[model samples]
Target: MDGTTVTRTPKKAALASFMGSAVEYYDFFVFGSAAALIFPTVFFPDAGNAALVMSFATFAFAYVARPFGAVILGHFGDRIGRQKVLMFTLVLMGAATFLIGCLPSYDAIGWVAPALLVLCRLLQGLSAAGEQAGASSLTLEHAPDDRRSFFTSWTLTGTQGGQILAALVFIPVVALPDDIKYSYGWRIPFWFSALVVVVAYFIRRSLHETPEFEEAKANNEIVKLPLGVLMRDHWKDVLRVICCAFIAAVSTVFGNLAIAYGVLVGLNESITLWLVVAANAVALFTQPMFGMLADRIGRKPVFIYGALSSAVLMPFYLLSMSQDNELLTFALAIATFSFGYAAANAVWPSFYGEMFSTRVRFSGMAIGTQLGFLMAGFAPSIVTGLGGVQEGGWVVTAGFTAVIALIAAISASTARETKDVPTAALGLTTRRAQRVEAATA
Candidate 1:
């Protein structure tokens, strides 16, 4: 491709990536909302007081499948092409989500109800394991050297869009009478995922494979076993990404655990869902700005700021819910999530993907983030088990947030600054050597 085509491809890739991620996370977040509000009653009715924990555990099941999914999907992503693998993940997630909507309730089917729910959730997890990594890698590769972070930021911004869409769809469902809400209102959002999947599917299908991957393939640099190459060369980067990825738990705490906590603290269920809608709505705008900022200042500082700010602001946000002030709660929610945690969320696509060469970038990012995201996946169950959704659970939740944020910050601080590096020079030891190799080729 020529320079103009190359330049334009990034925009197309970014849009396709944004749509795919929106569809993927929309399906994922719908399940999260249902797990928090509906599944305890619908899927785990027999568990008594443990029903909520069990419901959240079903939410975690996808995370458990994620690492394995990362290995399987990431291999094909690197081996075949990012575009093809992404198409499969999008369809798989949509099918699994739609199946969950079709499942019988625990009342009608006994243990088979929760069993089927877990199975669908695992499929969701498997699809998700590759979605972000593939989207990020593809967009980053297509993006200009100077604008990679800004372009790739849209992938995460798409996630915020998904969360907003999910919460909006569920808000009315939560307001329905119990009989209707429990009977079928919950399934509408899950079924709505099918429509979105079709939309994103066509968008992604029209986009071409990334130029970086194409160039690498043309030069015979594609690896047969990407995992082996990743372990042999980029293991430390993978470790850093895993630690840096712990910040994702903050999202679970905000989106899932906080909803249950708010209800526990006397906020209405719809109000809690509105809070999610509000924070993520603001994030739709803020995350991209943070991405541009990362491109200018460097990824580490922006990511670390996001991490530490989340730790500092989380307690105040949680505390506000019990203060009987809706305005205060809303303000704190925006500050804690949109302005604080969003910075790290926005920058990680570039920060992590830039660590590996195009050859293993998919595998490295997928395996690393999925492994770390296990904490994010199980965070609701773990914190709730420790009383995060109980009367005085905010303290436990806040402390957990602080610990993960600090660890992510410390890990991020150790990473190399790639803000000034050329697109082709990234992952190589030095710019001069990269140029020499290019000339020799």
Candidate 2:
């Protein structure tokens, strides 16, 4: 009872989550861009038509390590705390990303180059698996009763900032001469993550634990085996969140495949990079606005609307890419990613975290989201193996986005709306109602 109010913690926790996620996702998204644009030549030179496939396969290796990281990190987060796990993940990611920059190319080390890249990528995945879940859970637990959705929305706003930094940094690197570009330009971005690592570590470390977790500790009700508790008590919620997390595949299609497709079709590369920058800039503004709207209205309407809108908008955007009209492409890109995608992106941290109690929130979110995002991790390679960026490839990719978006919409519909739920009783309706009545009186 000596702790700060929920209103104060939400803003502080959201800021902490925002900075931490910005750093982690900056490392993660930059690699996705590198995999699409540069890795084929540097790491997989011998594969001819299979070079892209090989590049994306290397990208997918990280997803393989994520679920395992989720289980291990999530256990400790629920047992010890959220802030500690986030700090651990940040260090792990920073080291892996920096090591990636040091990897020798195929010309220097032959096949060992790609293998080392895969090993580092797995470490990146392991770090990321815990980053979002822990951050989201921390934010959600600290948020005020009526505005949980709005506060937790900042966790995802951090991701848009990361994407923007990733694209902006790579924009220049893409313009470098092949020798310089391949040799040192790609490495610069990875190395720069050290600054983010240092700044974010200090910001996150200054924060206190969430009130919900603190309360759970006071009651001696913290679960020892959080994954087991999550499985036994909240499996349905986990499954639903997994389905919802699959919508993340759309990001790979847009960010990674769009870069590959634009280059293959003879469009200018800078334009492609700027497209991501522009869309994310719009999202930086749009996501928080939508989050506020979710607080006023409800999470489901905004979430479902976003999923359906993204599913519908993907075709227009992908079709516009075929026409080679930069204006049309930018317009459609902004519409699809910033407005449409931000709808779901802004809401999910609150929506998904509210589906479980604080006792198992981090474990539940990490395991479910890591498993679902594994599908997203491989989407670009799968699309490439089908065909590289033609209309047929676009059609297949669009269909994939629509199906997953629909699944996310349906999954969100299954959860109870927690807009009015108190932070101390997020997954418990009766206790929340009693708390609200007591507060109101």
Could you give candidate 2's per-residue lDDT for residues 206-320 as a string of tens digits? 8998877887787787987998888887899889888999888888888998888877666788889999999989998899999999999988899998989999999888778
Clashes of each: 0, 0
RMSD in Å for model 1 = 2.1
Q: What is the lDDT of residue 424 in candidate 1?
A: 70
What are the TM-scores, per candidate, against the unseen true structure? Answer: 0.97, 0.95
Off-target runs (Cα >4 Å) in candidate 1 are 1-8, 47-49, 431-441
What tens-digit string does per-residue lDDT give for candidate 1 at 285-338? 999999999989999999999999999999999999999999999999999999
Please list the C-alpha lDDT of all candidates, in the order they appear. 0.93, 0.87
Q: Give per-residue lDDT, candidate 1, residue 236.
A: 95
The candidate scoring highest on lDDT is 1
| Model 1 / residue 126 / CA error / Å | 0.6
